[model samples]
Target chain A: GAGVSQSPSNKVTEKGKDVELRCDPISGHTALYWYRQSLGQGLEFLIYFQGNSAPDKSGLPSDRFSAERTGGSVSTLTIQRTQQEDSAVYLCASSANRGRVLHFGNGTRLTVT
Target chain B: AQRVTQPEKLLSVFKGAPVELKCNYSYSGSPELFWYVQYSRQRLQLLLRHISRESIKGFTADLNKGETSFHLKKPFAQEEDSAMYYCALSDTGANSKLTFGKGITLSVRP
Candidate 1:
């Protein structure tokens, strides 16, 4: 079976520019989540979507960060203005639902130069 | 708010020695604990969960509500087990959010 897939694998963006990261979850997985991994901070939950009911954006660091999942499968996370601090590995995961083990993608490393 | 902590940043063990990775969490309600492993150049995946009560890859974790810990343990470690491990806590009773620890890098020697 195909696992979660993320695009580009790596991205380099100039500071103050906007960037979009894409994620394609495994088929039949109802829940999708976005996470970021950085040195010292470990991994932080960014947002979560489950069958398009209503996205949980509580973990978004600021207003500049946003994500949308279309057709309940593919998701994209956008940063309006990138910063050096945002340079980290952006990971996406999917699961049958909450309380289940999440299957994660290899992640897209974004570097804000 | 729930938080997971892995105090040790790195741990080293011999190939035939026992290994224990510490994990602790603080949550208001009953929470579900999980251990996730990430081998080099591999995707992060679940190693085990408290509810399942099953061992995965020779690793096991016992949840202790009194100590507020769910440390992962293995009787004998292999060099392949060397990787970054994270402790996560899910507040299943309330809002569904997974809080993760900082993670610990384990190195196994032959």
Candidate 2:
């Protein structure tokens, strides 16, 4: 089975620019999640989506960070006005259902130059 | 609020030596604990979950609600066990959100 897929394995953006990272969860997966992995910071939860329920955006660092999972499948994480601190690997994961084991994608490495 | 803590940033052990990776968490309600591992150049994957009480790759973790801890242990560490390990907690049920720790790197030397 195809695992979770993320696009743009490497992305370099200028400060103040905006970048959108895409994620395609596995088929039949009802739960999708986004996380940021940085040196020393570890893996930080960014957002989560489960079926048709309202997504959890609590972990989003700022208003500039937002995500949308359209049609309950693909998700896009957009960071407006990117900053140096935003340089990190963005990971996407999907699970069969809530609280299930997650399958992760290769992730997109975003470097703010 | 939910938080997972891996106090040690790194752990290095010799082959055949016992290994223990400590993890502690704080949650208001019943928590679902999990251990995720990432080998070099590989994506993060589930190593084990507390609920299953199963061992994977000779590693086992016992969830101690009394101590609020879930520590991963192995009787004899192997070089292949070197990897990054993360302890996580699920915050919600229907819309479960995982809270991950800073993660700890385990290095097994021959």
Candidate 3:
């Protein structure tokens, strides 16, 4: 793809429901990142995947949040038992390499009602 | 811990006027700073990085290590420049995950 692509641009789920967001990064990109943007808040780092190394999951808010990247290309972010506070935009970005410019996707807006 | 701060949530400026967006950061190690912008209905994109020392769309940001600041400036603001701007920092090491500041909204009025 010419740019990073995210699926299900909008998702509204009831509280306690699980939601999954997907990202397809640009071809040949070696680094990928996930972030959360609450209403009127800054981007919060969630996780980072660099090659085959263990993902940097330091920023995951809780055990309910998890992510996996398959074949070093597509990634998925799963939020379990979502809470109302989880309502936010989930953004995905990919870069050619670590410390390089990041290309972002339109993001998936998750509304936990 | 690396942190970035954008003090103003909203700024208003007339078209053709100069504009400056303030940003401050704290990091123990050498930092790599960057500016990112998001226009309406657009994805977030890089505006500039301290390492490149280049200007995009007439906007420039100079890293002041002593002050721990990297402020974005433009000689003349344009209506098209109205958008949300974010300041971000990353550690100079291999772990380049970025830490972003609360974004500032720029409103360029005609």
lDDT for each residue of candidate 3 in B1-110, tens digit (9 for 90 to 100): 88999999999999999999999999999999999999999999999999999989999999999999999999999999999999999887887898999999999999
Distance from true position, residue A22, model 3, in Å?
0.3
What fraction of the true interface does each of the listed models get right, in terms of native contacts kept?
0.73, 0.73, 0.75
What is the full ranking by lDDT, best candidate first? 3, 2, 1
Model 3 chain B: weakest 10-residue lDDT segment is B90-99
Give the CA lDDT, 0 to 100, for residue A33 in model 1: 89
lDDT of 1 by residue, A26-92 (tens): 9999888899999888999999888765457888999999899889889999998899999999999
TM-score of chain A of each: 0.96, 0.96, 0.95
Runs of candidate 1 with Cα error greater than 4 angstroms are none
Candidate 1 fnat reads: 0.73
Q: What is the TM-score of each candidate against the true structure?
A: 0.97, 0.97, 0.98
DockQ score of each predicted structure, in the order shown: 0.71, 0.73, 0.78
lDDT of 3 at A73: 93
Selected candidate, larger lDDT, 2 vs 3: 3
TM-score ranking, high to low: 3, 2, 1
Clashing pairs in 2: none
Best by DockQ: 3
